[model samples]
Target chain A: MARPFVPTRMEEPITANHREARPSGAVDTRVEGVVANWFPRFLANGLDYLDVTRILDAIENWDQWGTTWEAAGENYEKLGRDALAAGHSETAGSHLRRAALTYQFAQFVMTGDTEARRRIHLRMADTYRTAAPLLQPPATPVRVPWRGIDLVGYLRTLSDDSPLVVLIPGLESTKEQFSTFEPFLLERGLSTLSFEGPGQGETWYEHGFRDEAYVDAMRALFAWIVDRPDLSGRRVALLGTSFGGYLALKSAPGLPVEAVVDIAGFFDLKDFDNLQPVIRDNFAHFMKIEPAEIEDVVSQVDLLGTLPLDVPVLAVHGEVDPIVPVEHAHRIAAAQMNATVWLYPDGTHSCNNLHTIVRPAISDWLADRLAVGA
Target chain B: MARPFVPTRMEEPITANHREARPSGAVDTRVEGVVANWFPRFLANGLDYLDVTRILDAIENWDQWGTTWEAAGENYEKLGRDALAAGHSETAGSHLRRAALTYQFAQFVMTGDTEARRRIHLRMADTYRTAAPLLQPPATPVRVPWRGIDLVGYLRTLSDDSPLVVLIPGLESTKEQFSTFEPFLLERGLSTLSFEGPGQGETWYEHGFRDEAYVDAMRALFAWIVDRPDLSGRRVALLGTSFGGYLALKSAPGLPVEAVVDIAGFFDLKDFDNLQPVIRDNFAHFMKIEPAEIEDVVSQVDLLGTLPLDVPVLAVHGEVDPIVPVEHAHRIAAAQMNATVWLYPDGTHSCNNLHTIVRPAISDWLADRLAVGA
Candidate 1:
């Protein structure tokens, strides 16, 4: 680790690395800051507990957050490259995936510069792309032509005849972090297409958060599914989480998918102002506007425009969710023509803390729904 | 999962399995009991976060604790057997090892019948033995003849020319839980022999806790090492944990060893009275004595008799250890002629809570100490 890092990676650098940005003042990194909120995320996700403990030990300040994570990621990237060179593809895939996961968390919740967060995030995407082909039953990076640009996705299918679960990313979350979710799909003998829509993941560089871009991305997703002979015949289900859940419902009208599952979706932006300062700031960063100006933007977001979805819909919400109220799930379920509401009594946002139970249940519910048409 | 009791395992049951024992009435599980002390141990070790959460959700009462764990262990045992039947040796080994760990925790602490606890303990050893031969590089179960019966040890070596580290188990911990600790030794090209001494693991049936049996087992270990040409003349270290630490120190005088590592070891049994009721009860079970009568045993145990050992010794203790006070480490270090004490400020019992930092520190310390004589 004393040796300077020369990352063996995918995609040449487009921006200067986040490593140069150092905290300028005496850092007060209360180690307990990471204990409560972030521990469950790291635990539920694939990050090794020991590695997280080690990585989080040095990160007491937001200024060093992404940088510390990037260093750890780079180490794994080097290990992956060396393992791959030695013809250990299995080992390489695992290591590179770990590297990608580190980078995913690096960009997750940044209270620092927005541009630096994107730089760290790009490394996540690149590391994951490097791992994609090496993963067992290899995933393919596909670009679908959308609104004069290509939206990125990773297509992983167990069988041609299996139903396809189109997974949409939420704010600050990309397809790379969906690795844990993919196993349930794979276990059920279902195909998975984890897509990065506009304002999410790689697509953010081309198009930031905008209503038109989001609507077009969903249209392009279904269009691409129809175009592919292998993917076209399979029953389709669109499963979205958090912000993406709202987007899924917004674009649900007349979509070719047979089923839709909205996980912790917002029914309206009335609760946006109620979000924590850190989260509000994160939201502002995506919109590139002041927090005060968000009321105007809030007025523009409402699901009633796309209500009473024709297809079978499932709304999954955590009753104890501090961010989004459980009533949102009830309201959404009440609106949709064929929607069912599931409220996990002890779940947090996205039910990530209850991932072991909620995830499999969601997969099972979706499988059952998709099976009806098949 | 719906299928009933049939275990594909190494041992034919001499005692009926603990699966039949059920709580008599309304079970007051109070899961928070597990949340405080057990979570860190589970997290630091190799258990999957999701599996633990799911498993803990079902275990609320100590009355059904061992029975619940045995059911989970049996599930994995079935999965392992099925995987092995399908010629998936690596997968089988991993699952079987998990099965072994579940059983390890099953018998860790019991508030009910000691015999039920013993029944569950037998499964842990048997399951681990079944997995030993399938592990990568393959671990072998070796029998070292003691006074009359035999002691079981899993010998996992990376190379022919390597120093061997004998890992001693604590009051309830057995060789089965040492899988997490073995990688560090393997990485350093050091051979590991995780041994279950008298009143530990499989050997408990033959010889329960007693001074003669404990001393003879340690003596027999070194004798066996000398007898085997492959093991003979190699540098060796006795690394004991908790009660095993006391035993390692107690047996250190006039032993054939180069180094000794005492992890959260006892200097004397003076602090035994202050231990938590559950732990004291567990220790009492091992001794087959009432808690109050343990004064006779406590008076007989002290490290002053074995003070100032000639061999290089490293005493690792947690400063904030709730079970064993940090004072004991200072006392032991003060007594030893050549001893170094490493007290982690934020570690719990056996430094199991600070395992991520303390474990590697230990492995590094032991490697450096052992290398000097090599």
Candidate 2:
């Protein structure tokens, strides 16, 4: 018999629609109290996740995402042992593969090292081949086209038909970041899809597409996924990481997304109001815009303004992040009523060891919503 | 009988010298766990402390600390309810007076604002007369020479028998940042001393001393404080913020400091390997060196290498700080086994909300040592 699923402790109840419209008021107080009480153990269990998040947040804002990816990969591998010991076999396997793939992606981004990326890709192929049979349906590769560029992605079938979760890679990231978890979900009967958008992996420099084009391409990808024979008419859940987090939030309203998750995502393109000069200058170059233009772009993509999100949203942020401020997460959560915001006192952009803490929570949430369709 | 000073639950046991030698291990995992859980609640407890700390950190790092004294005064007024509730009455009074004095100091630094500075000084004098007794020694005017120029400082004394705690303001800061806590300490039978060190408050333009000379002046000030009869040759605890954190760490070996606390301090200046460009440029100019030269200067002041310190040290950092990365704090903790380190998961540079959590810990540590001294 399968083990009964245990849900993680409820983090402040999902913000109801009525609560979102009003000032956060006493709910914030109550939630904060809960957080303060359990922060240390939460942190110890989540340090690696926090470290990865911090590194990713820094990379997204600083455009040094490439360098930190390697670091994050190493950390993920280190935490795998703990995950396996805790009986989270699926989580452990995913993290190990993610670690390997992240290192490959990092090398590719940092040095434009194609051979290193290919080596990792081969390793991923082997891992996936071994894990595929345990899943609901064999993982299928799909080619997504954006601005005459072809991007590769994997689609997994669900045991109970549910909304498709489309995972977007950060700038220079590939579909591999999601490969670790795809099989776990497929085995659990949850359909999932992950792809590399423009300016990432094989699409940007390889296909000559730029950053701004990604938002539209993501929308198109969602449309394409819905039309697929196996996933026809499915609602989509978009999960983004770091730079991808920003892209995911920005793209959510434009697509037929039922829910969205931004992990250490940026809400505005502008540098933080109190940013040090170094950050401001470096970011200006990364965004290819002047300091004066940042505010204008930020205004356009301000997550504080409702983007007509009609589904549940989840935002995870690191507390001590120097790159993306936790305020960004607050703003996003504040704007969405059906949002479940989980702040890891010691958690960062992407979940690592702490992922275990949030993993059950996320799976439970997804399971509850997906069960509706079932 | 004075409540027997039962330590708060937040206070971790001080392990033996070996535990101190491995400071990271010394951190009570239990306390960290508690903090992690309670973080959100701790933050909502009116984030006023964070605001205050930011203003103080800013003032301390200001190029002309004296000029911003008025702002400090304003902050004191703003902090009224919170400070009083926290038992920081003396700190409130000192900050108000310091603000007025800082305004005068700012004038002195502004090149053509001498007359304005004089007028501000007169106002400060009046404010001091009213607020001084609220502090320990009552405010008295004193002049210290720096780089052949005389700079003014306001001396407030606690009882001569009390343990002396010296406050070192950062760059442009005056003594006003400690105003809220100063009087509170005095009332608690702790002697407090605050000064605007060189390149701060009155010393910057007034003495034609740039920021580079701050370490020397702080050294001199520490030496002078030790020799004073009021201080009774007691080992002083030095609390430093931002750039002042750096200065305090540097001065640790030179001064017979009993304890040192650094908030958001940097370890290696050059290790800001991933800094945003604007900040890097600004810091470079402030340090009067090229970016390439940062590595060399970092070697001289690397707090990690300045280890085996005879004195107790506490390094506190915010994980999400945009100015100084949380890793800096981790590196410091990793380097020195004798240092006590506390990290706020969602804290930013000088964010006030963290104070509520940290203050109790700080008070307990100070009281423990002072009681032993008695």
Candidate 3:
């Protein structure tokens, strides 16, 4: 572990209502809708090329998007229910999973109205729950208590002897998107538990958004996993993507975790003011506050006292990441001597553009830390 | 079956010395190297992202390319051989296959010198031969006897009762690149036989190049597959890419095959004169003929008399394909009744840009025809 390096103030002035003043070309329309979602959509499609192609075929532009996904979700939902009626459990499970993913994507970028987002997210969660029992080894639902409410999650068992990895979704991501990523961990002898802690999916409805709520949720999750009869492993790892990366880092300090993966996460909140409006709007909406109050809460978010995580940390960031600055990775590495920071020269935010490289490396890193296949 | 549709002459004149005359930005330097070879390189890297990234990181431009791959091949070759010496057969097999692929890519686009091509091709073949026996289920090398010579190939078995599919490589492609594509076929419970016929790999060293040689080679391959006690498929399907697409269509008539998959292949030689110089020169070099003789021989290559294939056909092509026009797909479908032509509106050559759509559809179509998964 290295000495804690206090972060410096912002180099540029933080503009008020920064979203409107930001350059239009920063996050191009194509990048916002299609390109940014390719890997995630591929995951939702169960890595099936035909299904992905079919999705792409329906929507030619952003204007014709929402209904296509809704229709697709309905189609798959009908197919799944019909298959279940026909006693084709395997086929029903696959179709229902597809339906859940389709519903999730429909609400992926949807914000502004809580009622619509809640309706769509509830459908996504419900469909996933229906399909979970038929999944190989099955994903059992778990509710970890936080204050008076409960945080929703799913524990996907690989084996009792396998290491457990808690999957934390980003601001826009939900537990439903873990269908593809969960397999990588499972194949490497890791049990995956995906859940929305705060400011994500259904959890956003109850807990709203607070950075500390995520840390509290992780603590509760760890406690629950330790007590489960089917689950083993003294220490668990937190695998977080995007904003979830920040949560993983926040929870890493004093948390009983063997490893922490912060993929395109933030080291400091100094860059929060400079983020795109789409991102800023979503964060503010999740926080259950007006856009103006975002800066005050975000400013309180920093890794000032958090350092020397001691546990192995893996930070992957794209050098040209438009969403999260690459400097965050550098700062994380500088403050933590045991951190392995991989900065891709041509990668975008989350290095989703470089999925082929990032995905496998993360899996292998976690497997090594967990001593999988040993 | 629909009546044969004779193709009309080109509406525009073919350009002479087309390489220099073509638009400057058409095939950009980096795109010319990378985009054209993504699939092959993806295969060479064993479909591993880290391996591919390592190869990409080593090179700044195309000029300093060949030696890097040669060194990489040598490195893997040494590692594989050492593992073999230590009786780590599985590890050795995987590395040797990687070495063979690296060697193949080293000579992938090298066209000027036959000697260099032969040297690299030999190394690729030798390494693969050593690794083949160690592959899961093993790829048995079969020498299909041709006129006064032999065509080297590998028969990758899935099951004795499974239908066999013939993998015909494109002009620049060879059997070495089938490492990834073969799995798609095998997973569908189909056996794959990837071979180098005339104008491809070692076959070009011995028999030179002729369109008819491919048909002859397929005939020999079918005979061999039938005679093998371990192989029990009544019929075989021809799945070809690029020039192999053309060959698949050419051999579809009177060939004892269950189906044909012509991906981005052309129907007539009328468009040959209008092709890019890199393509024309490669064809001339393979044919061992003057560039002027290319058009004459190519002009004779048309599907006028050969049509109404009594088998299922899947023709996948990009609508805006630069190399082979999309109209070729339409013409092929018009001439053949039992044809499923998929034209991707925004796809590039061979529809590689639309691989997610094209690859799965072809496999599913072939599987449906062979009744493999039924």
Candidate 4:
């Protein structure tokens, strides 16, 4: 019998728009805009911290920017500084999280870092132990596949008429976390599907699917999606986050998908193996299994040796994403012949959260590609 | 006691240029240059084979101003077709490699795949074993390191007044492999030192310095370099190739070196880990060690974490390098604060042999930055 699924506290949803009380000061519009724009460009630039800082600095000093946003942005900068000084990255990341979220809601709304922005906002609420009343939870849930097994997924749909877009969450992520983009996509007349593949969410415990099965499960899902009547056989578009980027690319050659997007995805699995500690830490649950078995399975699914796909590919990555470093995107881009790469200078993996900008752009892209076909 | 170094037959000097005997009738100069320029860019653009073929068709039929370079560019179309049909990448890569190298030598070279262009040229001597006569032999003979060390290095003086520079060879490379650049740097009034670190030459057999020890050895070397009085406290610069790119960036932080130049270097170590079989096969000489020892010593010298250097950095990487991939350069650039990135869309890691293009650029860069008192 498989183990029972028990979601971690981090998986719980906090209230939306639970704006933290301002610390007795006017919001800085400039900082807000800077923070808002930071994530997309950062990711787009392949996650370069220097570029992120430069953009952040530029936005913080924008003319007529708000004070509150500036304060929040300053706080984030301080957090980063503190994290570096104290070697407490998680804490520092929290500060960036708050700054990104506040910037999203502030007067100088940022469009990028939508995921990070959302996460920051949610994390802020968690820190305060209060849920925002404005935040709405996901509407419907979907099923994600792993090997031959399936796990339930919670989805927030966007537009039915638009192209059927599937979002593959990163390691340890669930569909619930996709609330960051689901509604925003829906609001823009685009349909979005977010799922947790093998070794993630309920799949690991319920079905015992390991990370080695990720590509196969993703392939099966692609096969299933293309055959769906509701999707109307529309060209399937995939947006893979973090490690999912690698999974998406790996499965692309075998799937009949139209367009593929990798956000901070790893292209070469061998590269991941060299850094044993990182793999052990990130996939600790899966690593407890037999090494030889895992190696055999991983070898069969290695993406680097896989041939180029016959579809269009779009890679969205952060220049400064500490995890899932931007180089992975570069490798994917290099290997494929039909790939479009957008690097955000300040973005981190699965961190883009400001909805005001990314939502519209992503919607526009989907509309131009999927809506027209539909 | 250390076993004497036994150089490979490929290392021996050639009597004559092999290609000279082959009729130029088969060669399409125009197509060669065009394909060379276009292929690397296509790789850099991350296009799939379909897109690449489509783009090639467009370029061939497009009635733009019919320049000789463009006319010659059609050769790539045939090359691409041949590559696809060849099935094995080595066959395809050879054709592309030829075009890229030839294109670099072209007077009116297209500006694309800068790194690929260089890499093709640098690796040309090795890849096209018959073309050895066109290249010069190493100035110095391969020497074993002290104490049966896995690697051996020597700091040969090019000039007393010149700036100090360290040369790091590529995978399966030796200090002698840098014959092209060593003399070029010396001619440009720069002092260059070459070393066969870790997996390349003597180190693999003598010191048993594997992948994990790469950064540590580099750090130790930098520490030793800084204390040398013969160099007159001159600012040190690093020139790395292929795997050396990773070492360059990994060692950048916490070192007294002033600048680092990466030629087809890797940005992330984790990505390489996934290709354990390939890595082990190609770098077997470097990895014949106990894993426990590697784990114990790597933490103190790992480079993925926050780097502490504020030095200037220059990255010259091939956009289409099949071995190292260009994303590595992107990652390094993203992480470093003061970095100048030069992308040769068509160049490969062996940027030195791209008709000495990189040699001059690097020489100029070193002259500008490493010159005493500006």
For model 3, residues A242-338, the per-residue Cα lDDT tens digits are: 8888888888776678999988888877877677767777788778887677877887678767865879888888777777888887777777666
What is the lDDT, from 0 to 100, of the residue B26 in candidate 1?
45
Off by over 4 Å in 2: A1-374, B1-137, B206-212, B271-301
Error of 4 at A314 (Å): 0.5
Provide the lowest-lDDT 10-residue window in model 1 chain B: B5-14
TM-score of chain A of 3: 0.85
Error of 1 at A134 (Å): 19
Please write out the lDDT profile of model 2 over residues B275-340, one tens digit for every residue: 644345434433445568766554555665576467777777777767678777766666656577
Question: After TM-score superposition, what is the CA distance of residue A364 in candidate 1 from its true location, in Å?
Answer: 20
Q: So what's the TM-score on candidate 2?
A: 0.37
* Better candidate number, 1 or 3, judged by lDDT: 1
Ranking by TM-score: 3, 1, 2, 4
Candidate 2's error at B148, in angstroms?
2.5
- What TM-score fits each model? 0.59, 0.37, 0.71, 0.32
